[model samples]
Target: MKKLVLSLFIVLFVFGTSLSQIRPVYAAENDFTFTVGSNGATVTDYKGTDLNVVIPAAYAGTTVTEIGRSAFDTYGTGKPKITSVVIPSSVKVIQTYGFRYTSLTSIDLPDSLLTIGSSAFENNPLTYVEFPDSVTMIGNYSFYMNNLTSIKLSENLKTINGGAFDTNHITKLVIPAGVTKVDSSSFYNNNLTSITVLGNATTFGTGVFAGNPGNLKIFGIANSPVYAYASSNGHTFVDGTVLFQAVVSAKSLLNSHLAGTGVGQVPANTYNDLSAAYHAAMIFVDGIGNATIASDLDNAAIPLTSAISAFNAEIIKAGNPAALVAAITAAQQAMTNHPQGVNVGQTSAANRSTLQNAITAAQQIFNQAGQYLQGELDVAVAQLEMAIDTFEDVIITAGNPTALGAAITAAQQALTDHPAGVNVGQASVGTRTALQTASNAAQQILDNAGNYTQDQLDAAVNQLNTAVQVFNAAVIQAGIPTALGAAISVAQQALTDHPEGTDVGQASAGTRTALQTASNSAQQILDNASNYTQNQLD
Candidate 1:
C-alpha cells in the first residue's frame, strides 16, 4: 500500500507541473478577455457596458499586441454599447471582424497599428478615418458600410483587400506611393468623385471603383497601372504631376501683379478674385482641406488662370499721348493751309468744314486725362489724316477766259453780217437764232470768268465757234433767184397736168388751186428781185 501511494503522488505531481506550464485560453481582466501568446496578449473579447471603451495597453501583466477576431463585434458575448474607442499604442494588428457591427462613430487608430484584418471595423457609423503611416495592409471590407466622407490613407500602405472601403460616403481618396495592390471592389459603391494614386507600380483588381460616380477622376502617372485601370474602367485619368504644375503656374501668374489704382497695377477687386483662386488652389497642392481631389485642383486652377487674365486686362497702363498730340497738330496745320472760300483757286467751303470737324474730334480725344485706349487714339489719328488728304484733293485753280471771249466776239460779228431777212446774202432766220443763243451763253461765262473751271470755259468757246460756222454756211447767196424761177416753172406745169374738177390720181381741186397760187407768188418775187427779200422769194 505505501508503494501505490508513492506512484500516485508522482503522477499527480507530474500533472500539476504540466498544468502550470500551459497558458489559459482566455483570462478576464477588468472588462477585457484576452489570450496570452509568446509575444504578447491579444484582446479576444470585451464584456463591458461602456459607451466609450479604452482597451488597456497591458492586460494580465503582458502587453496587448492585437485585438482578436470578433472581439467587440455585434455577435460577441459582451455586445457593449460602444460609440467611441481609444486603442492603445501596444496594439499592432486588428484581426478579422475585430470591431465589426459596432456603434462606433469615432475611433482613434494608434500609430503602432500595422495590419487591419478583414471587416475589422465594418458596419460602423464612422464619418471620418485616418490610418497611421505605420499601417501597411487593410483587409477585405475593413471599413465597409460606413458614413465616411473623407479618409487619409497611410503612406506605408501596401495592400487593400476586396470591398475594403465599399458602401461609404467617401467623396475623395488618395492612395499613397507605397501602395502595391488594390483588390476587386475595394472602393465600390461610394460617392467618390476624385481619387489620386501616387504610385506608378500599383496594380488594381476588377471593379475596384465599380458603382462609384461615372464622372470619377483618377489621377496618377501618365502610363502607370492606375492610369491603365482608369482607362479600362471608363474613368477619367488626370496626371497628378501635371496638375500640380498647373497649380504652381497659376499661382505664379497671380502673384506677378499688385492691387492698386496706380499705373501697371490691377484693380483691387480683380486682385482679390485672383488671390482667392490662388489660395484655394494651394489647398489641393498642399493636400489639405476639402479640396484634396484631382478635380478640385483642376477646378481651382481654371478659375485662377481666368482671374489672372482678368486682372491683367484691368491693369492700368500709361498711354503715351505724344503720337496723338502730334497727329492733332498736323491736322490743324492742314486746315490752316487750305482756307475756306468760294473764290477762284481756293478750297471749297464744304471741304474746309469737314477738315475742321475732324480736327475738333481728335483734339477732344487728346484732351482726355490719360484714360483713353491707344486704339481709340489711333482711330482718331487715322480719321484726321484722311480728312487732311481729302481737303487737298478739292482745291480749285484759275481758268483762262480769253478764248471764250474771242469766240463770243466772232459769233456776234457773224450774226451782224447774216441778218435774219429775205435779202440776198443774208442768213436764214433759224440759223441767225442759233448763233444768237450760243453768243449769249458765251458772253455770260465771260462776264463771270472766275466762277467757272477751265474745262467749262473751253467747252463754251467750242460751242460758239460751231454755231458761227453753221450760220455762215446757211447764208442767202446770189444764185437763189435763178433756182426760184426754175422751181416756179415746175409748179405751173404740175398745175396744168392735174386740172381742178378732174379726178386725177395726183391732185384734187383744192390742191391744184394752192399750187397755182404758190407758182404765181414765186413768179412775181423772181421778176421783182429788187423789192422781195431772199426769205420771201424762197
Candidate 2:
C-alpha cells in the first residue's frame, strides 16, 4: 500500500509539471503584458506610449515568439503614440491588431517573421518597409491605411489576404515571384501608379484592384496569368515586346514625315521649332530601353505622345503643296524685287565666286524639287541668269585702263617691223589693206588715250588689242623677206602667247622693249629687201 501511494504522487507531480507549461495568460514581470507558451513568451499589450517602440527580443529569460492580438492597439481610448517599431528577429508571428491605430511612421520587421495576422499593421503612417524573405503569409487588412510610399514584398511570400494594403500611399509596387494567391481588395484604394507582377499567380481574387486609378499600368510577362488577369479586368497590360515596337514605330513615322523638302525651306525660326519638337519626341523613344510597355509608358509615354502630336501638326503644315509653293515663290520674288546691287568692275572676285556658287546651289535645289516647285525654280533661275549677264557687262567697262597703253605700243612695233608699204612681196592686196586699217585705228586710240576716261580707256584697250592682233596676222600671211620675217614672227608669237597688258605684273618693261626692237629691225630689213637680188635675200 505504501509503494502504490508514492507511485500516484509521482504521476500527479509529472502531470502538474506538464500543465504548468500551458500558461494561457501569465503576465510576465516586464514592461509588456505577456503570456507564456511552450516555445517562449508572447507580448499581449504595450503598457507605455513611447513614440518609438522597440519590442524586447526576450521576456523573463524566454525568447518572444509572437505579438498577441491588439498588443499595440490604442486600448479603445485613442491611437497609440508609437511612431516607429523595431521588431526583434526572435518574434516569428505578429498577431491581429499588433500595430493597429498606432502613429507609427516606420518599422523594420525582422527576417525571422513567418506570419502576419489580420489587421496587424492597420492604420499606421509607415513611409517605407521591407518585408523579409522568410515571411510566407500576409493576413487580411495587414497594412491597410498606411502612408507607405514604397513597400517591398518578400520574395518567398505566397499569400496576401483581403485588404492587405488597402488605402495606402504607395506609388509603385512589385509583387514577388513566389506569390501564388492574392485575395480580393489586396491593393484596394491605394495611390498606386504602377504594379509589376513577377509571379504568375494561380488565384487572383475579385476586386483585387478595384479602387486604383484608371490610368494605372499593369506589368507582367506577355502570356503570364497576371497579364491575362489585367486583360480580363480591362487594365492596360504592358510587356517588353509591345513597348519596344510601339515606341520605335512612332519614332520612325515621325522622322520620315519630317524629312520632306519643305522642312528646310521654312523660315529659320520655324524650322528650329520643328526640329526641337522632333528631338523632344525622340528623347522619349530613347528612354524605352529594355523596359516593359508599362514601364516605358510610365516614364515617357505622355510626353512623347504630346511631342509627336506637335510634330505631326508642324509637318502637315510644312508639307502642304500649296503652302510650299507660296513660300518658294515668295522667296524668289523677294530676291527679284530686292536684288543685291552689283558694283560692276569694282566687284571683288570673291563676290563673283559667291554668285556662281549660289546659282549652282539653286540649280541643284530646283533639279531635286517636285513638279509643284519647278515653276518657282524656273523663275529664280531666270533672275539669276539676268544678274550674271549684268555683272559680266559691268565687269569689262569698269576694269583699269592701263591695258590700253600696252596694246598701242604693241601695234606701233608691229607697224615699224613689217610696214605694209615696204612689204610688196607675195602678200595679197586685201591682206595689206587690212593691216593699214588696223594700224590707223590703233594710232587714233593711242593719240587720245590720255583724254579717255578710265572706263573709256578700258574699252579703247580692248579695241586696240583686237586691231594689233589683226595686223600681226596680215603680216604673217604677206610673207615678209626672210630676215624681217624671222624677227617679226618672234615678236608676234610672244604677243600671242602672252596677250598685251595681261598679267603685266610678271612681264618687265625690258622684255617688252626687246620684243619691239626685234620688230623694228625686221621692218628695216623688209624696207631694204626689195632692192636685194634673190641670192642676197637667201
Q: Which structure among the candidates has the greatest lDDT?
A: 1
Residue 231 Cα positional deviation in candidate 2, in Å, after optimal superposition: 1.5
**Candidate 1 Cα misplacement greater than 4 A, ranges:** 1-29, 76-78, 242-538
Q: How far in Å is the alpha carbon of 95 misplaced in model 1?
A: 0.8
What TM-score, over all chains together, does every model reach?
Answer: 0.42, 0.40
> Model 2: which residue pairs collide?
83-104, 417-523
lDDT of 1: 0.80
Q: After superposition, how far is residue 513 of candidate 1 from its true place, in Å?
A: 99
| Winning model by TM-score | 1
User: lDDT of each structure?
Assistant: 0.80, 0.66
